[model samples]
Target: MAQEKEIHFTGYEKQISNWTDLIPAERFTLLVLQTLTEVSKDPRGTYITNDRLSNIIGLSPTRISSTITKLKKKGYITVQRVGATGRYIKTRDYNHATLYTYH
Candidate 1:
């Protein structure tokens, strides 16, 4: 069997060095968010749902939601609501995922 390739995150030191105030969960979530942003290779952001984040981080959806809000409040990330058609817009015409841009 072929072994899966391991993935690594770059610039992690810069991400965590200045944020000594972060709790464990917040730090882990921020790292994951930064990794996702880099992997997506999009300047806009990474489009994701709370359920997906929960699965990846092994956190409850509610917990993940609150963590994300905390990150936003700390200016570590910016979130933009995406429409059903995958466009950023003012109106929430339907349920949609959010695009997370890591700072």
Candidate 2:
């Protein structure tokens, strides 16, 4: 078995602690948050759409939509649509890149 290696979180601990305080008690919030943190490699932000999020997380689009809406309303993130399409997942519809900045 490989030895356990120490992992560094940099200065994200404080922010994450605060996030727990920010997000209200709800189901799926933690799951969505973990996924967002994984995607956001940098502190600046990352581009991800609900469609892509659904696929990567194996959740239905409707579930993704509700989680996103809650996150937005809670001021956990700011999303900007970068495409003129109605969807952004791998579909036969228009494609888009959604910018997400975690707060």
Candidate 3:
């Protein structure tokens, strides 16, 4: 069985309101919103590949990728930090890691 992780949203009120107002038409954006909310809590910063997010949210990786791209285009998030190149090697096959901050 996959161990479930409980996500507590602490710093996500104004942004929630902002996002809701800015992109009410994008329905599936909530999943991406909540997922980013969960990861944004890491003080050391965080990064999520589509595969990891797909596993956590029970969606296909393609969906996660598209949502991420859309979120970036919408300007709701900004890359705050990034890891070294090849950081995801021998892991999820991603080339690097990026930490995003919500607006």
Candidate 4:
């Protein structure tokens, strides 16, 4: 029998809590987006799976899926499904968009 490896995450609690109030509607979606952003900032592009995301954020797949759909609908993120793999792309340029300003 093989011993299971333990994953340790330090300081992530604060990051997750900070996003609780900033997300538009669903916190899970925000969590996923924020995690993806952090990963993208790294020199190595990290490919995260839906199961890994759900486990890391302590949310169910159904919840994550629902949030993903909402974020996609709002154009905040892009999800590419190629066969069994799903890729998530966050629109970091949203700040430059004119939707936030009063017209």
Question: What lDDT score belongs to each candidate, Candidate 1 first?
Answer: 0.66, 0.49, 0.47, 0.56
Better of 1 and 2 by lDDT: 1
On lDDT, the candidate that comes out on top is 1
Per-residue lDDT of 82 in model 1: 65
Of the candidates numbered 1 and 4, which has the greater TM-score value? 1
Score residue 34 of candidate 4 by CA lDDT: 52
Instruction: Using TM-score, give the best candidate's number.
Output: 1
Per-residue lDDT of 16 in model 1:
64
Error of 2 at 40 (Å): 5.5
The digit string of per-residue lDDT tens for model 4 on 1-103 reads 9998644242233443444334634554554565666668643323567677678777787776776677667665666554677564553443465534321
Give the candidate order by descending TM-score: 1, 4, 2, 3
If scored against the real structure, what TM-score would every candidate get?
0.67, 0.44, 0.44, 0.53
Weakest ten-residue segment in model 2 by summed lDDT: 88-97
Question: Any runs in candidate 4 off by more than 4 Å, and if so which?
Answer: 1-25, 41-46, 98-103
The candidate, 1 or 4, that scores higher on lDDT is 1
Question: How many pairs in model 1 have backbone atoms within 3 A of each other, for residues 3 or more apart or on separate chains, i.e. clashes?
Answer: 0
**Residue-level lDDT tens digits of model 1 in 1-103:** 9998644454563446456778888888887777677667556667777788899999998998899888778777777766763421111111232342235
Quick one: ranking by lDDT, best first?
Answer: 1, 4, 2, 3
lDDT (0-100) at residue 10 of candidate 3?
A: 34
Model 2 local distance difference test score: 0.49
Residue-by-residue lDDT tens digits, candidate 2, 1-103 = 9998645343233334444544433234434444455566645345566677777767777887777676666555555555584421111111121332234
Lowest lDDT block of 10, candidate 3: 86-95
Clash count, predicted structure 4: 0
